[model samples]
Target: MADFAWSLGSPSLRLGVTGLSRAGKTVFITALIHNLTHGGRLPMFEPWRAGRLLGADIRPQLHPDVPTFDYRGHVRKLTDARVWPDSTRQISELRLTIAYESATFLGRSLGRGKLDLDIVDYPGEWLLDLPLLSKDYRAFSSETLERGREPRRTAIAADWLAHTSGVDPLGPADDEAAGRLHELFAAYLGAARGGSLALSMVPPGRFLMPGDLAGSPALTFAPLDLPESGEAPRDSLWALMESRFEAYKDVVVRPFFRTHFARLDRQVVLVDVLAALNGGREALVDLEMALGEILGCFRPGRSSWLGQVLTRRIDRILFAATKADHLHHASHDRLELILRRLTDRAIARASFSGAEVDVKALAAVRATREATVRRNGESLPCILGVPQEGELLDDHLYDGKEEIALFPGDLPDNPQALFRPPEAGEPGFDALRFLRFRPPPLEVTAEGVSLSLPHIRLDRALDFLIGDRLA
Candidate 1:
């Protein structure tokens, strides 16, 4: 079993980086490591600014079983190729050792201090599955089915719901029947995740992003409409799914919690709030619900026998609204406010005693620069960047070669404005034009050494997460 307790020797801190698909988890990790190792300008980071930080370098990852994060390859992809690195599909780890001088006189007299910072990268999809631990198969089925009937999901779920209508829960279990249902259900989940819908809370996370369990019996089970107040018949479809669900919890979810999540000392949840806003009210609400469920898994005061035996509680959590570069600097604080309001209920529900929770709007790899454009004799704040190939605006498709200044619409002054659905003829979040931008070109020094990736508020985020420890 992985050791949950930290050894007293050189201090080690495990920082978890997780977010849903396209939320920039991979880029965030890459930028964080690159900044520290390459001595990127992090004026807000106290240790670095105070001249206490000596040096930072990559070290051998502690976990042999988990794959090392491909930092070098990802760096090449971003700096050399000028394209974003691939999104995270599985759990990976990277170790960075920072040597620093202690601020305290007594500590400085003792000697230099070295801290091992272990960065754990994993899919946010898997975090959604943590709620499964508290729910039975029947509850899972009923809840999933109810959500599928929601207005935002109903259309995408039509084919799956239609297929489920013909499925008999009490009918004898058949491989063919189960396989067909699983396929349809997985398809619905995929559709819900695509485009402007960007729906969250799609559970049985493996259905959408099955890493290795693809085609396994554990993954083949889909939620079915079960009759109320009756036990599942032996050898029936319900029984088969229930068994597989339980097996999945035991074989997949439990191991992850015990081995990785429970050991983390700090965590960063990257959120693409712009995407959620672009997706409209339904998507925003869905993201809130999903975030709440994920936070519930980290409920504080875990003093149970198993909790005591398994892992320590995370002390710091940072929920970051990523891709802040998409908006003008003026809207960054507004974006942070929106995220804070979005997750307010979730933070309260978790009630993490002795833990500090914070939210910020940040871009780990800044893809745009601020500019002011005059339109109709009025100056407007804008962002200038190279839009990715095929990006569309005003019926014009970008060829990816020209630099353009876009006046992405402003965020509401009141965060609550995002919660309510728009009224008839009212302009909704659709007014905001968020285009995917390619990674910025890297700057090289006179000696040919490449500077670190540019970012917005990454230093403040790092300070909040690990500055105290470095001190």
Candidate 2:
């Protein structure tokens, strides 16, 4: 009862937006802001559709310590330059103040409603480190080493593993050795993330996207081969590495959780499911495991100890498969189904008491339009757009200026087929003929008024994330 009063008196919500690299996090944020500020069409967002939403504008962020989200700069890049904004490399915050009319009779009698929507944007790579909070140095080392030895990862992990075999855990600490190990390990992680591997379990995320802590000792350490049950010798390499790992969790991971994550009221996890699908069964399963681990960090139920300490919980979590524009509308539902299946275990493990969970296929900035192409007397559903230059399809290279129609293949009717390993002489899963597309040119009126960014179901996402608050 007291909490309800507090919420009503001070209407504020912190929304956390996160996703792996190339998952459209930056574009999503920019499009969302542009649509709301410009009074764009949002039929699915009840607050906007019902005419209760009066206005929404950017205000100064509440936290002075954190850098402001570069809304203007990103808008310029997207609107003026017609190019996508760069991916988020660090933490940033933005506050959107919304004015609305009250829905209830009593509230309407009182006056207009207002809400401070604080949006926190951060790298999803950072969330990968949360599982490290409970893991000791030896446990982390053993798990990472085991993963490195997996068949799919062996090729990429060879250089790092070769170096690991030569280093003695109990030998004297050497800065050069540590640096070399860190570099090799970081390179392996980068390789796994690139192309079709799409591995998501890489930790000490600073190593991969080290913003300001590039060369710091806390980020220099890598997992080493150590005995199953033993203590590290005093001042030995193992001991030094262990200490730095703890420091990273203490100084880097914990602060992020305490300051930013703990305060979030809602969250949107963007995913590039198409990329994983293209990678094959291994990448899909790895992505699922990674998402499960990340979801476990959320304090879902009020009975949890972390929930008690934080005094707030993430009451709603929306797992969205981004870049839906790459596929035809006919496959959108299947895409959503795949995402739901991918997150099923994580959603169950979270067991968020009184929390709502949903999955959707959305394109923050739709880059394609629906079309039909005729081939062999059959009309095939296709998406027409300008593929980025050098994007190859069927031995043809796109020049970036030519509009082409692409028939992105269909997803399986039963998403369960995605989990099975491929049989001999068979492609693992139904691979989409996906290609990156340049942002669509904006529409403008004769009077020089530009329209809001076009999107696929973005308003529905807005409704799921914040519609209840406005009411």
Candidate 3:
């Protein structure tokens, strides 16, 4: 018999599952926990595969709320139905413990250990904004301005852009003007959040709760005043901007960074690259810009004395292209190709600092495979998967057609593309085409786990985050 308490002597790993809105954070968390504890149908997730995973018992104390997160029921719902709508709300604090056999530590023989995984299932939208706390208002506005001009979008941003352009780019940081812009900016951001713009900067529900300072002046003012103006007045929007910027850094950014981002042993930056591609050329551009800007918050390229003053605690970063099950098996590489293009700037900027950077195409759920629909005998790259639930998920027929135009749900209408493709191969892929994903089995084996990995990536993520404490 395994020494349950003795195995408890090992350190528990703290994992934060973050991704863009609709990027599958909840489903992933649910599937991960369900598979880990119940050994239900799930993709192979290493440690779990070694089979020595003693039967896991999930108690309310470890996980606290169970009804709020009916993981098994959610999986059943998605798999049973022919179609599963995307997740719309944010659910928080779902924890699960997995007991498994681990390789011996140093001279010790192999024995069982418990992975007390505490998972935070947040809206990917809010998680993506973690990097935004670093930027000042002026810089934020400047970046937002560029993103507002993408060709393939139509929304509040268009109107906001008009207002921003009319505001003298070189004018003083007038407080009233800045306040108006702030409201407009917040509205635009809220709209973007609601619209499905995949930009990493938009905070989840921030659109819903503009906070107590909703009608207040905008913070973080970079003077649009000419360089010749020298210094603007202290009471100007510039000062309000400065104050808010400081507050954001101290009040908002600092605590999150210290408690979560800083404390994390590893990170998974889930990018919806396929969704961006499906949104077409404009979506691609916006995705790149947002990703680059977000990554910039962590890298700190050239040290300002202030830059030296503030630093993020995240040491290792994993940029993953989520929803891999949406693509045909062959197109996985192509999906990665598109992801590389979107994140090239961010990756390059991050790699220089010696932080481990990896790009992966994955569907934590493993939804479907590429197949062809022969309605008119036209061969197209299509996705194939079973539609039944429980162990019957694969018992149904393969369905779906080539998505001519895919809506990335709520992304901004017009967004920027960060990188240009090196060259297009035989694949006549538009920026907006991608394979739709299917869910993984409720019960999976070690080999199943391996397929889910674009590489030994999860192990690497865990190692960086928790390996130091392994005994």
Give the TM-score of each candidate: 0.95, 0.94, 0.65
lDDT of 3: 0.51
lDDT of 3 by residue, 1-471 (tens): 112453355455546566666666655555455444544432243343444456455543243331245555665665555244356354344446666555455423555666665555544444445455666555655565665565543565776666666775445556668667666766776666444454445542233333332343323222232233344356655555656655655654445444444444455667777665555455567667667755664566455332454434455666677766655556566666667667877777666464666666666565554455555765555555543323212243334422232221222221222243334342222433333433433433667642221211233334344444333
The top-ranked prediction according to TM-score is: 1
Candidate ranking under TM-score, highest first, comes to 1, 2, 3
What RMSD value applies to candidate 3?
Answer: 8.6
CA deviation > 4 Å runs, candidate 2: 1-10, 300-309, 422-430
Cα lDDT tens digits for candidate 1, 229-254 = 88889999899989989998888887
- The 0-to-1 C-alpha lDDT of every candidate, in the order given, reads 0.88, 0.86, 0.51
Candidate 3 — worst ten consecutive residues by lDDT sum? 405-414
Using TM-score as the yardstick, the better of models 1 and 2 is 1
Off by over 4 Å in 1: 1-8, 300-310, 421-427, 446-448
Residue-pair clashes per candidate? 0, 0, 41
- Please give the TM-score that candidate 3 achieves against the real structure: 0.65
Q: State each model's C-alpha RMSD to the native.
A: 2.2, 3.2, 8.6
